[model samples]
Target: MTPHEALDDLTRRGLLRSLKPLPDNRGRLVVAGETWLNFCSNDYLDLGHDPALVAASVRAVEDLGCSAAGSRLVSGHLDLHAEFEAKAAAFLGFEAALLFGSGFLANLGAVPALAGEKATIFCDRLNHASLIDGIRMSGMKWHRYRHNDPAHLDELLTKHPAEAGETRLVITDSIFSMDGDAAPLAAVAEAARRHGALLLVDESHAIGVMGPSSKGLCAAFGLKPDAITCGMGKAFGGYGGFVATSATLAALIVNRARSFIYSTGLPPACVGAGIAALDRFAETRGALGDEAMALAKRMHGLLAEAGFEMPPFASPILPVMVGDNHLAQEFAARLAARRILCSAIRPPTVPPGTARLRLTVTRAHTGADLIAARDAFAAVARELGLLP
Candidate 1:
């Protein structure tokens, strides 16, 4: 069958998915012309709609106009971008940083540029799609280890020690986005160091959520600056991504990373917003301590109490494992009907048979909100015969 026929087959099988439109109003996710309580968004801190961010964005447009207008190598580079990059690098304890328009592009740029033709990349199985794509783009032979299994990575390295001379690279997400679990970065780093391999971590989820001062997993684990590429949008509550590394590595990426070199720089508004967000993170760092973790723990407990099977993750990305795609979709739809929004994560986004309702808890949600969410899940599960 042709590719289009395969797509049609997927649609017929109720597997094809489309975007759900969201409205402009606060906390409103629009689906079928109705607003619902959003739980599927990655806006963990709920900073996406913060008044400060909005104000900063407005001021930026007023001062700097709309677009970056050209690629960074051409005329797109701006003083705002430099300031933001400098702040981000310093915050993350890196010598220098390079920004890309988006996290996806940053990965695409850095991964391939750092690892060349003869390099071999060892990647974790459950990493974000961007890292997987980056590894593929790197044109290096990549071996996938079982999710968070440092032993598998060690085995791969031991079996193929010959590839070490060709810039052996091991890559993983510091926090798995879908699972909401922290990676064992120390173990991974140890294995990398043991085999003289370089570690590349994408701390997209943990940059502003985990670690002291919202630095990231590398800081949490004391990994060197050269080990990380962070997405500013997720936890930074802003736009763009950066490769935070030593001066030499930063220079190399700036010189060779095509995505950063060729694409339009991040917008001045986004730069300002990012800078503001980073500053906010630093100022409010103490507040992120136990409250966020406590909230996540409470949600996990409530879900488990309601007999929902949650995956093992300490981060805010809580997954209620439903095991069946149709049921997962129905569960999400039922939640939506009740004005609580969640999305059914099915095949391609997650492995088959692991379809789940990926609910996120934020500082914005209260204890009562969590209870309501639990009640909703329980009601839906019981109604659907998923729970007794």
Candidate 2:
């Protein structure tokens, strides 16, 4: 189709997406000259505006002068980056950790490195786009199991035909990005072991939010996967990504991952801020996580009582599924009109009929904020005819 026709189609079908600028964003979101109770940001720790983290970043800039200068293999490598990686590897219980510019780049680099051309990848159906893109780039054979279904993954691993020398990799997100559900990591590890495959997990949303002391899904299960990737941008309250693995495997990624090899390193300021953020999280691990979980439980209960249906929520992401796309947008609009901000996750992000308001709660939100949120949801549900 022509560009005009394609644009027209998207506009007519309510699929046209646009960026909404959120400036001076803290717990109260600033969007289009209005402040909103933001339930859309991934700043799970509310540290985006934390004074300590900001100070750390500024200190790094004063010392290191902003840029990393070149790719990590080149002159870009700095002592600050090395320090963070060492702390991260030790913190996550891994032999070594390699940093990347972003979580997207981490997956985009690591997936292809672990599953080269001759390997077969067993992927979770709901794995994020970056994982899928990396798998595609590898040119490796791939099979997607039903989301969070270990039995299906096991079946695929057992039945999928491959050559004798082909390696097998099982990849999934520890905490799904859109659905706010966690993959069955223990069961996945078991399946991978039985199938003689290496397990790769993306802990992007779980690293600093889930598990005791922010150790992630593997720690929660006490099962060490072959490789894991975590992002500093989410609950870490910083910017960057990391893949933790054996020292040998870490070496392999540095040598083979194209994205990492080609891109300049994340700024020194980001690394310093990341270390500070992690330190801050470790200071009060369970308290922050438990508080957020409690608030989310109340949110789920309130919405369910209001007639919204969903599976048991195990993460802070509370998706209020509204199956129709237009209705989902309307629900978001109504919430925004009430000074609440909940992003409408529509098709392409989710399945065609599974549009939702992807409401996320952070520790930064107060009890009053949550109560207001619950009331807003109830009002919107009633107006949308979503309530009984």
Q: Clash number for every model?
A: 0, 0
lDDT string, candidate 2, 203-228, tens digits: 98887777888677788899799999
**Candidate 1, poorest ten consecutive residues by summed lDDT:** 22-31
TM-score per prediction, in order, is 0.94, 0.96
- Model 1 deviation from native, Cα RMSD in Å: 2.0
lDDT of 2 at 367: 78
lDDT per model, in order? Answer: 0.81, 0.87
The parts of candidate 1 lying over 4 Å away from their true place are 2-4, 25-35, 163-165
Best by lDDT: 2
Question: How would you encode candidate 1's per-residue C-alpha lDDT over 1-388 as one tens digit per residue?
Answer: 9999999988775578888666542335566676566676666776777778778877888989889999887899888888887988888878888888889988998888788657888999998898888888877888999999999999999998854359888999988887888889899999999988888899888877877777777887777735588776775667788888888887888888888887888888888788878877788873663466678789999999899877664788898888888888889899988999888988888888888888888776778888988999999999999899
